[model samples]
Target: MSPELSFSGLSVLVARVAPHTVATVHALLRDGARVTVASSLDDLPTSLRDLAERGLVTLDPRADPTAHDVVLRGDPSTSPAPQPQPRVAPGSPDVGTVTLLGGGLGDPGLLTVAGIEAIRVADVIVHDRLAPLSALRHARDDVQVVDVGKIPRGDFTPQERINEILVEHALAGRNVLRLKGGDNFVFGRGGEEAEACTAHGIPVVVIPGLSSSIAAPALAGIPVTHRTLVQGFTVVSGHVPPGDPRSTLDWGAIARSRTTIVVLMGVATLGAIAETLVAEGLPATTPAAVVADAGLPSMRTARAALGEIDATARREGLGAPAVVVIGEVAALDVLR
Candidate 1:
């Protein structure tokens, strides 16, 4: 039988062969592998050398890959059952407030239990075009769903107008959900809406979602940062061409760094951005990748050197809402 263990107690030493287990234990100690116990666990450490222990560590492949708090997140015997969902808050239907919810990446599975609860309780949802539409199903039949998504050079919803709607509905004594595709603070213009609410003395709340900047690349098997592979990474918007005077990014400095670079909303200006990087002394041979339609079953990816990424994207027929990753780590498609 496998050894029983508790990360909290740290009383149990779970490891492998005498030498390897010792080393693994040391590393776990250094890295503080100990997790705050939410439930209780036993018989683990898949890296163990003992075949009997490995058998105990095995789990259903379809289950969540990793546990957050093993005590609360893992198997039924070790983890507690999910709690019953709460009903919508009283007086929620008519509250002068605006709530910003990050709809997460395009996948409905990415939505958190808390986020789903908030959606069900909301009076109205003013959503972005890129946000997953499936989440709206959680709303009540009486709840109003509004589309305020902005498209490139197409049916644009002015920021001022969105703010107006937020204020108007909120003042009318309704709880409004300003649902955006990714984290509200990350290029989602959530700051403007919050400011509008504050100026009007309206209550505001933010429920963060996963930003596509990192999620898109991650879903495509790209890590924003890797040990020894990337010392750091930079994330920026590529919506505006580098040549444009209005562009505020310091392309020169960006090219000088070896840190990974992640560009969101820049597939259109990718050619110009690549040209600027090469001009600023970044090697034209730098690895780069484009991940399109991220979080969807139809997602696609194209890879090439920075010098050839634009051509690669063209060949792939990739479009906007894609993430462009450039750096030494871009080539690291570990999941592939």
Candidate 2:
């Protein structure tokens, strides 16, 4: 009683397994297009595998991308498939390069030209949750976007697993782009990735992005440094409270430094951070500010004296993925 599947002349090659990609493949299959996926059967969702068992999809890593009418990307925004590139068989002997790219804050507009170029040529993009999603829009239709975003204290792809995926894709002759938010070298664990690739003889490159530690504060109209306000600044991670064993920073030294202090990933422990600074000789009345969701449309900033900043940010409902700035300059609205 069902209508016959159509797509007599259309062929689709699926380069990755993602919610959008899988859904697209399902539609393509239902419409009778020949669908070939470049992933192992074990990697597919149950729904996709059911379709495969019904002779609707083919799993082939060596699938020739050009043979298909279109190559599929996971993002729905990339529909209509990009112009086909010179067909090359996946898993070819050609060694692919890996580019570690910084996605800047949350704004795609902040992505550097070099970073965009890298995305354009990448065969696979291994990205974090914070990376600018716009880069995915510019990727080739056949590009495989692997979401490895890490959520603070939530479900996330393990670093070891991410490292394995990069090496695996590159070894299969596919250019891999490792994209993360902020400058990759700035607590982004880029060094570990570079080391992983080079250990396997894969060539690696870096495209730096504007770090939120600096960009976020600036966008919120707070300068990290001012000649008359402070002589220098220190950037620290607030992932842990000051006295937690996991933290290696010396709060006393930071408090006594007499310079601007910029804290990243510190919103959860902002109160503790403020307390430690005050307990260590920093003035309780020092000006401070919290810039949340920088570069995005919903960005918000809350300012208060150092002792009250944590309470102020909470009262304002600011959350993680924010930057905290402490110094005399925090009170100055230079842009205003």
Candidate 3:
């Protein structure tokens, strides 16, 4: 294919290749980049041998293990051949499909293999504020990104509007991906989206994401459940206060159960929830931890007794998009 955009000054080197990544390389060739294809960067052409030393480019030049699945794009003297793509099935017209992908906890690298595939093929992506940003960089340049992120008390997008966007795009024969933070069904309102798609006769596909309730704590070195200590665990949404009539959680049962308690979206009501648990028989000395930005560089964790967790959270200024663990496991800091 002829070059559409010129990467005239750019130099690209691809190493340890995979068959699927070849298409991206072909794209680079079409863009007019001076690309060098080698099994390893160590064996670069004599002219570009010092490329690594010049420090012109490096996503992470430190030490990329000689083996990885990333496909890099570049160009050469001749146009690169396009890789073969799957054929469209006969009689099955290409209809609009909505894929709900889990963006993982905070770290972009945590996105699942299937989630990456969905992003690469999507025509439009409607993402949440907490969605893994690193995963979005792999999307094709032409892909449309729609921000429908809902912050706690800040800018918010109504759910109906999000559903409308998905349905409207699918009706137009475009593949839309609703990328969300954590598992789509784990308080993600994914079921409602599926229902909307089904009501409108649109095909909906859901891809599970890593929920913060479990992954966040683990990233902060506190497992929600332990082999010998915790036989089971319970995850609850803490958006409502214990005394609120609108709340449906059974605090009494939760306090009586032996399972670990993992709360999502409960930062605001932590104090009331903790007090209720203690009133309902949950010990005040139970171990607890509040972990924010679980897998990111700024990740912070504050651990204390259940009676003190609310204060610890206040002192640390920990905010939402965090995982709260209360039980014997939160006391353990094995990950450090």
Off by over 4 Å in 2: 1-93
**Quick one: ranking by lDDT, best first?**
2, 3, 1
Arranged by TM-score, best first: 2, 3, 1
Give RMSD to native, each candidate: 15.7, 11.9, 12.2
| Model 3 C-alpha lDDT per residue in residues 31-62, reported as the tens digit of each score | 44544555444543221222222222232333
Q: Best by lDDT, which number? A: 2
Candidate 2: which pairs clash? 129-149
Q: Which stretches of candidate 1 lie over 4 Å from their true place?
A: 1-95
TM-scores across all candidates?
0.72, 0.75, 0.73
Candidate 3: stretches off by over 4 Å: 1-94
Compose the digit string of candidate 1's lDDT tens values, residues 70-125. Answer: 32222112223222234333345444678999988767779778789888888777
Q: Write the per-residue lDDT of candidate 2 for residues 3-96, one digit (tens) a residue.
A: 3445545887887776446436634543557778888877865445544654557888778887888786554644453232343333445767
Instruction: For each candidate in the order shown, give its overall lDDT on alpha carbons.
Output: 0.71, 0.80, 0.73
What's the C-alpha lDDT at position 120 in model 1?
86
